[model samples]
Target: MAGTGGVRPSHSPTLPSQLGATFPARPAAAEIVRDLPWDDTPLGPRERWDPVVTATVDLVLSSPMPMAFSFGDSFVLIYNDAYADLIGTLHPAAMGRPAAEAFGESWLSPGLGGVIEEVYRSGRPFLEPETQLTVVRADGARPEQAFFTRGHSIVSDRRGRAAGVLTVAAETTQVTRRLQNLGELTSRLAVALTVDDVARVVLGYALTSFDVDHCVFAVDDGNMFRSVRRIRGEMLDEADERLPPVWKRLPDNPQAPLVAAARSGRASFVADGEPLREVASDRHERRIRALAVLPLRTASLSGALSIGYRTEHNWLPAEQALLNAAAQQVAQAAERARRFEAQHGTAQLLQRSMLPEHLPELERFRIAARYDVGVDGNAAGGDFYDAFRLADGRLAMVLGDVAGHDVRAAAVMGQVRAALRALALTDADPPGVLAGLDRLVGSLGAESRNEEIFVTVVYGVLDPHDGTITLASAGHPPPVLRRAGQGGEAPTAELVKIPPGAPLGLGGRWQTGVVRLEPGDSILLFSDGVVERRGRALNDGLDALVAVAAGAPSGDPRNLCAIATAAVPGPTDDDVAVLAVERAVALSRSDTMLVAAEPTGPSRVRQWMGTRLREWSVPEQVIGSAILCTSELTTNALLHAGTPAQVHIDLNAERLLVSVADTGTRGSVIRAHTDAMSSRGRGLSLIEELSDSWGTDPSVRGSTVWFELLIRSTSDSPAS
Candidate 1:
């Protein structure tokens, strides 16, 4: 037969020809045509043997596996139809051809050719479970040896001599890949600890270790589902793509089938092709090709886990089992964190309600106060401010901070604030008030184990009448004072620092100090938390308060108090109380005027009467009479009105009059004291008598008897 490449086919068997030349022919058995002899007969016995040899070669080559033969330094491949299918149409008639001439340089390999030669020379069978090789076609494309397994055997002659080497191989490329996937899945499962960890591991495995377009995991937070982790291949950026809208539009009639299934404590698998075809109303039918939804349920809550693929692919039973186990681990961790957060929230609310409601009112003072709780986690601190009206009508203010931050500290603050208020009402002095408070706190401390909870307080009481404040401190910041001027000028403020003492509950002695507050002065009291911030010195904070208060207006204590509080940057982190008192002064006295005059002459009295009565718009006759009366009174005082005389005047809406008096060696003795007298005593009595009423404040220097005489307008001058 002629091959496609124009090579002549040889009828002679190369293996027998080489063996016949090396060894003698042997006899054959009677019935079994075994061990045929090798001889050089042109139409010889081997010539008859050639037909059987050809049939054997045809049987081996027709087998499904690819087979090849090599004899006497020449090679031939008799590939079956299955092997031909693997090679495609390039080498369809690959039989009885030299290994080198048929496959060319592709057949030149030391490892493969040496193995074939060893089998032929040793007459031994060999098997390679896996082998890799490359095949070159007539075209320019290179076909690389995707994996394969090979079986080799030595073909022998009738003389038991090695004839040729035969090889059979089967492709195993798919099996090797399944093993690699199994390895990756095992590694990922080992490290998944939490729900977030499981989601990340599974999503990464799908994208990197399997054939997946995109993978996502959504965890339920009560009403809605949120994507916790997502992964994708080169086809998509998982971070950039929004999840399928169907995820958002879960089954509204119930819950999403995925969510409902998870909540029901079951897992679900949705095949991309069949499920949608069966259920026409499925909203996610068009969005996803395939899905495996597993519900993550623990003792407390339930959520869903899903894997998605762009192409329709069946999820194996093993993959579903792996995902379900991962979801359970994640669910338990979320439940623990939720419980911890709830407990913390409750403790915070309890601490906030323990502070005082509002500051008490003061008669001549304005009070402003504010308290802020700390933000440090769940712990609650004890910072409080209180003001109350004492029994004496004085305003008592207290600001204190209990050491520590916890439920115990808050409880202690409540007790201490109540004790201070009761003590303040009983004791008039500030130091005495604090001393009583300390005694009460000490008595309470005897039963408690928390010896470290001490209270630092600044307490004070304001006396409205004297505009004085007595203050005492138990290692607390000194109160601030802001004073306003009478004419509404800019005000000045100062910190009224009293002697510091030990904190309450320390069983140490304490003392009180006094501060005299003038009218329009304010007192500011605050706990140390306001001034003692992390990185700032307490003095710096105090100085800052002083500066802000100094520039603040003295309009109303409330307004000034706000300004001062605002001056300290806060969330006070402490309690603050400011009590301001403005002393009220009576500026106008309308009923009486005090006057001291010397008698220069009767004209001097007349001039005094003209000037004083003219400013009042009195009639000329009344003015003249007033001057005559004053002249008579002064002349009498110089003679009878007495020496070193002082005149006193009284005015009202209805009447006006003046009285003059002088220092006398003898106090004026009026008979009947009301005028029933003779003219000599009557002149002195008439001047006293000239007034509506009179009285005397006698001194050693002189006796001042002042009287009021009604001045009549022409309308009502009854002749007396």
Candidate 2:
């Protein structure tokens, strides 16, 4: 009524000055109504108006809310000052006219006239929750988007029959817009993975949705509270770098507005200064005149969300309901993240504790291990490895896997690892140690009443003084042994010959095998995860491991461990554990090259390998043999794999072992060596005749071609 400006009617005479006293002081729209010539219209003079019509007019004019009364069959309009402002430019002229004629185009708006007619015909009240319309603002020249909640109540004449309709329309554009966009907010929150993510999403959404100057989202964290805030459009969080910054840390003042709201379990509005002063202690907080605090309530989480405006503003019922609904969404999202993080944290902690904190610091032998969990990282897994010095001064190493991926499996694995260490301390013998672990696992399975407790393990004891390892396996894959070459002999690699006893839970006999390790020798102990793949045979995975072990760099145990774990080429649903124990030796020279999947790759490998061999003082004859053999392998790899290949060469005093590995499926056809005369299988023929020993092995990742060459001794004459 106050800010709205109306258009003046054309050629309309003003009422007499003395007539002003006839009507009490009123709003602009009501003053115009009192002075209008009612006798000229369908309705008679004011004094002769029906008692029912007069009473209705008095009721509409006295109220402040937007209300318009349509009287009799013509449905003449009689509205209060608030209604005048709602009608914009049509105010004074529309005072005594029919609603349809006065409101013009707006009268037929979806929720306006249609609702009014329904009430008039049925003598019933009709309501439209929300509907869009075009209405010109008092200060604008053109109409703009507007929405309103229309309510039409039937008004009856003195005869107790349906007469006309009285409409009450409350402008709800802001409320409706906010409600409609809430779906977008829900979608964003659904993907939130952590507590901090929920905070960022909630705080950011609230700031923009309510058009507030500042907003904060705080969650209860036992004694302390974590919060994320957005101030003047800048978002701030406590901990975020590699991950999305969620709620970090904030002051947990007990009497703070947010704390009070969470504790009160409801919404609190602060529109007055005295209340704002009580909550506003900081410089920024003191500038806020209005605040709305809504509690984030869920079964498992307690928190609060707050929005503040710099100026005084009253929150309506619709707005309050929308804020509460948003708070509910925030609560649900927070609960999901909380549960996931809790389980993830527990799984990681339990698995780490089961493995050795840091590898046993040993000087005589180099030992390294690596463990990677499957996709279900939230589930504690059974894969584990440990290396520790035995009481007899020998080193004991173990890599094992229990069945399933859950807390129970992890618990069993932990017990088995602990038992192994304890038994090894009492007796460094490999068979005794594994025998003890078998009994422990069987007892645990019986106690837990789990029928699927299958455990596979490899226990080995390395003698530093003699460079010999005693190993025992219980339904586990045999360990890989990479032996350094002897006089004029090529180095060799194979799965150690050992007894494959039944799994621990089956209570099978345990036996041990002994292997003599030459200087510069390396042995790899791994879990079934190294070779167990879906839709493939166990022997296929095992054969792939031997190829990887033979081709990998043997000088460093850590490097070998990494290469072995990554041999899968792609994702796997099994956890992998690798432990490599090597006997350091002299006269070892190793070099590697990455050959691109192009025509010129074989030439580059030849040049690189020749230079490395010459630098090592390799005999010219030996260098020529290596260079020629490596070229054929590299060429075959590029032609068949269609992907980059890794050329790894290891040369010692007695021999050189070189391999070319590729990750590609196109090589399957080439691997078969079809068409003996077409140059496809020619490379294999040359390798077989020139090299001492050679083989081709294929794994899930791809395929590998390897060869060994023995250098001639100085005492031996050169080939004629």
Q: Give the TM-scores of the predictions, in the order they appear.
A: 0.37, 0.47
Cα lDDT of model 1 by residue, 182-291, tens digit: 46655655554334444555566556644555455555555755444343533333421211111222332234555565667777786674333332233344455777
Candidate 1 weakest ten by summed lDDT:
11-20
Span of ten consecutive residues with least summed lDDT in model 2: 1-10
lDDT of 1 at 162: 58
Q: Clash number for every model? A: 11, 2
Give the distance in Å from residue 515's predicted Cα in candidate 1 to where it truly belongs: 4.7
What would the per-residue lDDT of candidate 2 be over residues 202-247, giving only the tens digit for each residue? 7668767788887888888776565656678453323122223323
TM-score of 2: 0.47
Show model 1 residue runs off by greater than 4 Å. Answer: 1-253, 256-262, 265-341, 361-368, 375-377, 448-451, 463-468, 482-493, 514-522, 548-720
Off by over 4 Å in 2: 1-181, 184-194, 207-212, 232-255, 271-289, 298-301, 310-316, 332-354, 363-381, 405-407, 442-451, 462-473, 476-501, 507-720
